[model samples]
Target chain A: MIIKRTKSHIAEIFCNVLCVFVITVVSVNAQKLNDDFFSPKSRLSFGNYLFLEKDYLRASNEYKEFLKTDNNDTVRFKLSESFLRIGRYEEAANNFKSLFFSTSLTDEARLGLFKSLFFEKNFVRFRQYRLEENYTTEKFSHDIDRLNYISYFFDSEPLPDSSRLFSAFADLNRADIKKFYYMKKNPDTKNPVTAALLSAAIPGLGKIYTGEIGDGITSLITTGLLVFLSANNFRHDHNFRGWLFAGFAALAYGGNIYGSAASAQIYNAGVKFNFDNEVKLFFEKHNYFLPEFDFVNR
Target chain B: MKKLFYKYFLLIEIFVVSSLFPQDRLSIQFDYANKLFQTSQYFDAITEYKRLLFFDEAKKYSYKAYFQIGKCYKAGAKFDEAIKYFSTASINAANENEKLSVYFEIVRTNISRRTTSRALQILDEIEKENTNTFIRDSINYWRGWTYIFADDWKNAADAFSKIKSDHELKKLCEQVEKEKVSVTFTKAISYFLPGAGEVYSGNILSGSITFGWNLLFGYLTINSFAEERIFDGMVIGSLGWLRFYRGNIQSAEESAKQKNIAIANKILKYLQYEYKGAKP
Candidate 1:
């Protein structure tokens, strides 16, 4: 009886242990599997790895995946950045536009948009911002202050008096002012078209009027030779030769007229260009007259 | 009952072996694809990566395989197809860095294709999605390169200047800006004076050649008349003088064009081969 009882006790304990093992195994099997493993951090990290390897397309996809689980602003910013890296300005602009109103990056986006416009050479729109659009001025005051001088030529409209043109001279000290006044008074004297035409009609007359004696003499000699050749050809009874001489005479006459006109135009343009440069140099030498934007002071 | 349990155990073991075998096959396929990619055999690499899908237990590597396939297509200059695979990888990748890499690759491929508008969009997305400074700086640097390729030198300069330690690229941008000749101004100069365009473009040799030709022809034309040989003068002046005079002007225009081409080549040569700055 004792042996049977001991055997029964051992059997019961073994059965209990076995049951517990089976139950544990079945419960573990019934538990949810992590088979649908999708880790955003891992994807983003691997994406960065590929990006560092210069595999941009793959990196872009990985970032996009990360976005599905994580809709963070920083990620969006990076996405737009990658687009711009590849020269997708239009799309990049769109992405940036969303951030344009955000306080943290609004200024950056605006500047970036401006840069994009500048690259496109859409000067018309660029002008519209300072003149027509009248967007908030406080955000870009420093940049505007720096760029205002260029706006004079960059814009289609007339320039404001408070900017460089007048202020540059007004702000000059005594010695600088004296130089500026002299430069203004002695404006360049260019040859007049009527003068050139009058001189051209009389061979050396155009060059003389334009104050170029050597050039006038050369023109007179050239015209006189051609005229003599036509006359001689006609006298020698060479009809074809006379006609050819006449053609040469015609060319000389036409060339003189054209050259004289061109010289006058060039002289005038040069005068204007020089005058502008003089004023610009005077101001540039004097620290541009106004004040620097004073970012440090601000 | 014991016999039945033995049979069940055997079946599980067989299942595990089969799964392991497929995994091994997938690993081999991945290795082969990577080798092809390393050798720049992009098309073949894409094929090998695609072949991994037929294996039973390759789901874990599916994301990497898709992304690699995109890279292969990108390397092959098939930007559109690369974009597709990259998009798929973005959806499939489990690692954030991997997803970012795919996005960046798409952007880069677009740049290589000169699709600037699209590339910019990708950059905007990256800026929005990323907070890492290194990645940001790198993207900005490449954006500069994209602008350079688009011939927007000022913008390229601006973009390059924004990056830290990007001095070389900044200098390159400045050089490009300095070398750029205004097309309109060049043409106008040529129209005003026969060889002036070439002279302005710093082609002194070609410009002097044109100037000399015109001067010589003009001198001969006038000298003939001064000698009083009317018939000989007329024939020589009309035929020889006129031909060379016109020829001089045409030659000036042609040389100006050649000089412009040379200037373009100078910039293109540096950009294409010798540039040490960031490039596609």
Candidate 2:
């Protein structure tokens, strides 16, 4: 009787194992069916709705889900475009690259990838990628020419044509003109350390170089007044008073030199900020100078 | 059996209800105190904080609450009450650092209220505690100012000079010492010479007035001699010159001495042992 009871327990364990295996297989298959029934197009449509609602983060997730099963080139292009629209340029670049080997849209994809890198200001890779690819599209051809001039501003390449740069400056906002000048002149001007040292030697010279005439003149005058006071106090035999004035004179002179260097840094930051904004604005107004994906069908 | 099961279920229900309710009375009182504090009703906030200490189960915030009550009283210029609450915080605070901080507050509040003696007592306790050297130095720095408020010029000079060799407080102390003059001595000197007290106290206006009065009296005495009415001139000159000369000297001394006292009082009022903001 005890042997019969042990045999039944073993049989029951085997039956339970079989049942668990069957359930696991059925659940896996059901999940696959569910995924297929939902369809990538439906997910893309929902993603587009979310995108229109201005939920970029959620829309990016939904588009990524659709792209997993939908390898159609047109859908792929839209996925890249969606990422770019939502400011997810890194993901957009990866998606755009999937079309780089396709003969039909290779030119468009390369240009789209270039734009993604440009927006992110990854200049090194953007320059390298452009060098590796050869494009036939008229649009990309024109962009390549513009890129050449822009590259000169960033890299230590020789300054682009002065007349062309000036004409571009004239068309830009009045505030941007100073930035354009900074970008144009920075590469060729005297080193900031040299300028600051020169200014320290003469209280107002660095401020003049930084285009701050008022501050330069004020620093010079203040320093001069303190020096004069110290000298006069010394001549009058007021040793303590003379030393106090002399100490103040020295402080003023040191502070002015430090301030001139700081001013130069401020000027440099302003130049970069203005130049970046102008470049971004110019491209944004021109639809990023790239192709659109209108080939995707319902 | 049914009765025992029902009793157990009833106990479980009560436990669940009590847990869910979270002793709303304590929370409501704490919230009210916080609201009062935010609204700048510092006096009302203090009352609420005291109420919470009486009724609230959580004692974690009690020390901070008491300290804040002290701060409120200090802000309102109720120095005695502020010092009392700050002392309570010092006694009841959980951590050594917290106790030290409370001790600092007590010293600060006493300084604000111009209660230098109380502040010095707290400072003494802090020093005995052997706390941070930096805190010790800061306390002594303010202790010098406390002496200045007490009008103890020599002690103030001594306290300031202790740290005078290296720190900014030394310079401030030196300036104070230079500006100080003995109140009685100023008045007494003016009695001997018109405007002498005013000049001693650095009062250009009152000193000039005294000088003019004495000069006018001297001129009248000289004119009497020039007119050749010797006997009449002698009596007139003696009466006018002596009375006016004495009065000029007395007025100069009084004004100069009053000016010095007024300056001292201004400094005391500002650094009152009861002030709430960061001390200089």
Candidate 3:
């Protein structure tokens, strides 16, 4: 009896595998199973739906599973785009790289790589990769050039030529772009050393120079009042009171000097913050001047 | 012997083919996704569930897939997305029963998200739609939980009382409400007497130090002016007495706030880890 049951069990396992495989194989005869939910074609279809819905994280996973069996340029590009959308810049760059050399999507892939690098703040590497002769895409060269110029406005040194930068953008955007360029060229920032020296000589002049006018006036009045009090006590022959007032005035003067230097540092930080926010707002609103591409909608 | 062989072979083929039918295959897929959910592989489970939804053209699985996806997101503590998916699931619900379940899921997520007003609003809407004993109980239970998360323990106790006067959560809420410090009283007393609010909130050492400093500075400034040292009096009063007095009031207020926070946190911790009930 045991031997007979073992033989039946082996036969059952073989039958199950064969049946599952037959069901999955969608030949003309097996039309009913063509809509199998786990099939690669269905997965790709579902992935497109998710990608269109902006559900990029799940969309990327679906694309990965579908790509395991099928090789399509649009799907690969979308997979890269999904990664980029979800801030997975490294993975996005790698996927875009696969479409670089000979595929019809070389131009799109190159632009995608540049965007990923730029968003990741890898400016040096982005420049190196963009300027590589073989890697440049002729179709998107202007877009890439504008992106490079924008990166300079963001934080890069030795900024691009002002006129060239202006010509790269449209007429409507030129005024805003020029504002960013000139702000980068000659930032309205204060020097901490100059502020400190000014304060040391005139109590609160450095704070006024750094745009803290109200605080500067208060500091000046307090120090000046203490000095006047010290002179009054000495003229009235109150030696101990005179020295106490003198001590207070000296302490206030020293504090104002240190405070003025610190104020200049804070003023510079504000300048940088405003510049960065404006540049970021402009680029984000304009999509960094990158062209629109939506595979799902198409 | 040949007849017996054909009979067994036919039985085996029938068993395999029956399980391979499209409907049964979708069931297999659902089970696979559910297994991932049960194992705490939430992200993977959502992907599989989305796949099921996409290919189940009949949409028979839409409600279940969306519902389970919401649960997975909830387990991951992503309350916003969990609520979104649960709301979607409610739209797909086939009947009032399924719709109510998804609605409660959303309310529970709102409670977890600490948006108590939204939770209460949803619960009230559910209450208006449902009057069955079991569902009423469920609604009141969640309403009570919303109050608990909102730190309105008095209302929590009242809501739970509607379910059962002696409910364990109701008693816990009552105890918490009774033990919490009164912020208004603490602030009032501090205005009347320096650092008294700190003492009321159980900060005896800080209260005593604040009182001592204020007393010393007060005496110094009074004496300086009495001795006709106007400059000395002005400086001492502005720089010493006023500073300590203002600091005392602020410190007293902070102490009261911190004491109440500690009380709330202890109960919240109990509800999170120790209480044997459905929580936010």
Candidate 4:
């Protein structure tokens, strides 16, 4: 009787365990099957995953979907950032503009808005915006100043004084900025009229003055040879040939004069291009004085 | 005994469920990636493919994922990354056909990158594998394309000729060859007469200028010599007449070469955009 009782109790316990196991398994399966992957939580996680992968377009879509039901500032910032990453500057600016009033992200959003404007290459608008009363931030003021100074290099806007602009840059970069400032103020320009006059006085002298040694030498040789031919023909009584050679010499002389003036213009343009390129490269190498944002850290 | 039996049954059920779950998830992920690829969202497709690669414990989709990643990179014009991924796919390929397909992709990418020598080397390797006639013909066809990218029309023509007697590309190549000005002929003609080669090569204004300069200088040199002015004749002949005469010949040759290149490039541009035929 004791053995049967023990066996019955054990069997009852086993049956109960089996029932719980089946229920648990069925509930878990049902939950998984019915799960909505497009929920806010799921979209946020998936969107974060895509963002980390640099799939900005899809990530922005996911963020947009999540933002429909949720209004998290960080997510909005991320959505705006995704737009920035994919070069949708106008949309990014608008999105970032909405966050300019947020307490926690106000500064970051302002910086982001500035970045969008800067990247659009509308320096005039950027300068105009920077001059607005509330557009400046105390925390990022130095960075904003640096960007403002950098803008002067790319446009015809007058640069600020050294003390104001160079204060935002590193000690090493201060020298470079000063050089750029001087170049902007008094550009190393070649005078086209002077170049033309030199070439008129002596064939190829203007090209030589403009640092085109090879072209100058070639011009001198060609002009001298034609003149010599004309003189020789005249001395030898070949009047028609002498006249033709003289005409050729005149053409060469006039062309050399025009070419010299053009060379001076080209030289001045090259100087400007080189300086602009250097300024651009320096700023790019330093990330334009902007701090690196770790959006995922918090 | 009853408790042990219940434990064993539950354990088996859990095992079956767990085993089936991952397989279903894997298929879903694979389908998601395929959908991304089909929609021409190559950048997003690459991300999905990479996700599949990370979670795929069975290595079931490794080769396919790598191949698709390569295609995405190729679409983005990132040839170096595309080549690297295609090489990985070739190594992981399950069969000879898959391997050959990857190799062909590498060749195509190389051709697009203008690395004609590398493309040709791979084509040679494929040729040595003793592929069937159709495959051989395909190889020759791509070889012709590689030559075209290299701007070697004669070799391109030869490669296409081996595919068939009168291939369309071969005919195009022949047409380009016929339309091209002969650089050597222009040089030879200019050597005999200072400006005749320029006129023959259809540079009438340049030819007239060259002829006028040469005639004036030549007359000066001859007139100086007739008047027994040795120094004047020598200076005029050597500096003015000889320089322009030699310059005319060099210019004519250079013009002919440029004209040939221009003709070839016209056909090449047409082939690149408008040709309704096989291409690399």
Candidate 5:
């Protein structure tokens, strides 16, 4: 009976061990079945991972490899996007142009091309492509129009009507846009001749009119003190002292006139600079109304 | 019975082999990632390290992978991302040595970002930890580097002095400190004598010009007053003499500061590319 019991125990142990071995082999096979390292699909997933990590160069290479076997629009767009992130605008534009005829991503690709042009500061070509009928998208018309108006602030293009120019901007930005438009249309320019005349009438008055109060005060004090000293010396019969002070007073007056005219020009330049900055910042804050790329979710 | 025992042994062997297979695969992937790192394929190495992290079921290589990812980001000059990964590595460190290494990397990244104060703060934190003498010495070494990068050669010298009297870096720092001009002293001398500070700061040409203007204008003002030409004296003294004197002081201070910056930058550039010593 004891022998029979021992034999049965040994058989049971053998069966249990066999079951464990079979489970291990099956699980290993299962894992292998799910992983296909060399396949294009896996490469695309890996590329996306790298792109998310901001490793654009490697991501672009991976997308390029995947493209050899696949002609997917999303991958193409991503490849161009990778180039765009790395500041290779020319290559990005070319890649995006290829997708401009794709059925599903044509609009996005066209917009991407415009963005590439804008980033490259080729505003003229951007405006030209924007007006092209082939590249127009009904859904994104407002964005394109906003970009059109914003371009005027950077370049020498004449601004359009306020209502039409700011129509595409959000309501919150209407006041700022209107202010910018008004500044562009009727700039607060100080006349250099007027500034010089004002300073001639009153030493440093022209600088004050040009918004340089500190310089105006200094000029007034310096010139006034010298002129007063000259008159007082002449009253005391000190001709040499009077003449010396008189000469310095004349120099101060001449310098004040020249400085006032230059100040007016500086004021006008500052006005232009501030206006340009405001318009650029407005568009930048709104991202030019462009749609955020939804590549990750897709 | 003997046949049954033989079958059982065979089955146990199969189970043991199968379980060891995944571990072996994990080690191979880890080595592959390391090889990529060694070749400077930082982006690809990052991907491989991530793969290793993903497949490592027991989390054995998790901290190591994170540390490597930090190093890759650092190589790419992405200091913010490098700090993020290094922080993760520190949190997952299994031993004090690993934690210390991650801390060192974080400090190095901060130094590259030019956030020297933040790097010093991290070093302070490392010093507070229960670390060995070797780690403490390393901390002081990097602290000296942080000060050097900030152009604070005096403080750098002091930090390196903690390592040893004859340390190479300490000597370099001391030499730089000795060669630097004192901006405050230059400005102070210029206050008493116009253009003197500029001359002391090695700008002799400018100093001579400033001195000549001050002297000419001073003579004119004094002569005008002696001749009872009050208006001429007032105008010349206030406008010409005072302006030159103030300008002399300002230029002297500026030149001294610039000279010190140039000296510091020369040493820093040498340390960055040519020095054969250990660096952060």
Candidate 6:
């Protein structure tokens, strides 16, 4: 009697285990087997993995696919941030712009849109953001204002009054900012007209003023030699040869004058390039003085 | 009989559950990614491959997924990114053949990116790693291709000749080597006698015209000096004779360089349009 009861109790437990096992197998078999691998959840998980890998181009593609089926602000922010990272600023701005109206990410997206425009060097559009979009976030307006002041240094936009531009930056950065301000205000420039006039008086004198000493000296020698040859041949009654030499001398002298003016223009271009490069480097090293957005990275 | 029936039920349940698992799902994903690849939807294919890599917890598909992603990148001509993924594939490679396959793609990428030095460097490392005769022949083949892209026909011919006594590419390289003009010879001959280098470089009319000008100036300059016209002689010598003489040497050297460039472009065109072998 005892053995038979024990056997029945053991059978009851085995039956229960088998019943649960059969239910699990049937339900699992009934569903699409690979749905878990390609479902929205897996996509988000995969997109996040690619996002963390800093493969922004691939990450953007994955995020775009994920966004097609889901409406998640964090993923949208990440997608826009990925575009920004890869220098696709237009797409980045458009994507960020989509987040502006009625979302918790409105402030970040607004800042991202402005950042895209600013980094694209579209200063005109960046400054006209409020007018163009009829949108502004009270939260990030001051940050945008800082970028607005910073943009003036990068482009040919007229600098605002010193007090206004200075007020946007912190006191700690005042010295460096003032240096850039002064550089933009009183940049050293050479006059092309003066270069031409100087070369007209003395062949190669303009080139010397433009810092091309070798070219200047070569011009002077060539012009002076032809002039001396013209004078000598004429004194010796070689009339045709003297006329030939004079014509050549006139051409060399005229070419030198024109070259001097062109050289001065080129010099001025170099000065502007260096100044622009310096400003670009400073801002790049300083992250353009924009506040760090660590939300998307998180 | 009831105990036997219970055992049978447990077996059926275990088999059903185990069969419906990640392995089957992962296999489907790999095949799906390959289908996308076959359709030339490279970017989508990469996404799918990455999808496989993401869910492959056992890492069974890691090497294949990474390799396919690298291939997609290579197809798009994004060599640097392709190289990064290929190196990653190499790291995940399960065996010698897989590693060689990854290395070949990397070297090929470097070649296409025109970083031939790096390509050769990797080939050299590969050679040192495996000295199997057949693999060495394959390495020599790529080395030949590397030299061909670099425009070093002599070395390319030498490398290919080592593979076969008369390989088609080796013959082409040799033909180019024989037909091309020599820069040093052109310059040296022009320095010794003006117009000769230009004539050798196939600039006939230019060579003759330059020769006539130099000869006329030469006579005039010597005559001026013979007549004791020192100033005239100095002017003619410095201005006319020296100008044409220097211009001859420079023009000849330029012609040689351009001829060599033409030969290189012809060979490259043949390779791009006509050759049957796999190209970097």
Best by lDDT: 6
Q: Score the docking of each candidate (DockQ).
A: 0.04, 0.02, 0.29, 0.13, 0.18, 0.30
User: Looking at candidate 1, what is the lDDT of residue A131?
Assistant: 62
Ranking by TM-score: 6, 3, 5, 4, 1, 2
Q: TM-score for each prediction?
A: 0.40, 0.39, 0.83, 0.68, 0.69, 0.84
Q: Write the per-residue lDDT of candidate 6 for residues A187-291, one digit (tens) a residue.
A: 776788999999999999999999989999999999999999999999999999999999999999999999999999999999899999998898889898887
Docking outcome class, model 5? incorrect
Q: Please provide, for model 4 over A134-175, each residue's C-alpha lDDT reduced to its tens digit, 9 standing for 90 to 100.
A: 777777867777787787788887777778777878897788
Tens digits of per-residue lDDT for model 1, B1-280 = 3644564565455445544554565677688889999999886676567546434353787888988988887777788988898899899888888877887777778888899878888888888878788888877877887786676777878887878545676776677677666655755765556556667767777777766765676677678778876787787777876675566556555665565466546776887799765556
Candidate 6 lDDT score at position A276: 91
lDDT of 1 by residue, A231-296 (tens): 898999887888888898878776776676666677667766776676567556754333332221
Q: What ranking emerges by lDDT with the best candidate at the front?
A: 6, 3, 4, 5, 2, 1
lDDT of 2 by residue, B2-85 (tens): 544564555455444544443554566678888998888986676567656644456756787888888888878898988888
**Range of the 10 consecutive residues with the lowest summed lDDT in candidate 5 chain A:** A29-38
lDDT of 3 by residue, B1-280 (tens): 4655775566566555754577776788899999999999999999889878877878989999999999999999998999889989999999998999899899999998899999999898988877899999899899999998888999999999999999998998899898888888887887778889999999999999998998999999999999999999999999999999989888988898899788888988988999887777
TM-score of chain B of each: 0.69, 0.65, 0.91, 0.85, 0.87, 0.88
Candidate 2 stretches greater than 4 Å from native: A1-38, A52-54, A102-104, A133-139, A144-148, A151-202, A293-298, B1-280
Q: Return the lDDT, model 2, position B178.
A: 62
Query: Residue B272: error of model 5 in Å?
Result: 5.3
Pairs of residues at least 3 apart in sequence or in different chains that clash in candidate 4:
none
Residue runs of model 4 more than 4 Å from their true location after superposition = A1-62, A197-205, A214-257, A296-298, B1-19, B35-59, B72-81, B91-98, B112-114, B123-280
Worst 10 residues of 4 chain A by lDDT: A30-39
Q: Kindly report which residue stretches of model 5 are placed more than 4 angstroms away from their true locations once superposed.
A: A1-39, A50-58, A82-89, A115-123, A138-154, A161-183, A189-206, A217-262, A292-296, B1-62, B72-81, B109-116, B144-276
Listed for each candidate, the true contacts retained, as a fraction, are 0.00, 0.00, 0.36, 0.00, 0.05, 0.23
Judged by whole-model lDDT over C-alpha atoms, candidate 1 comes out at 0.65
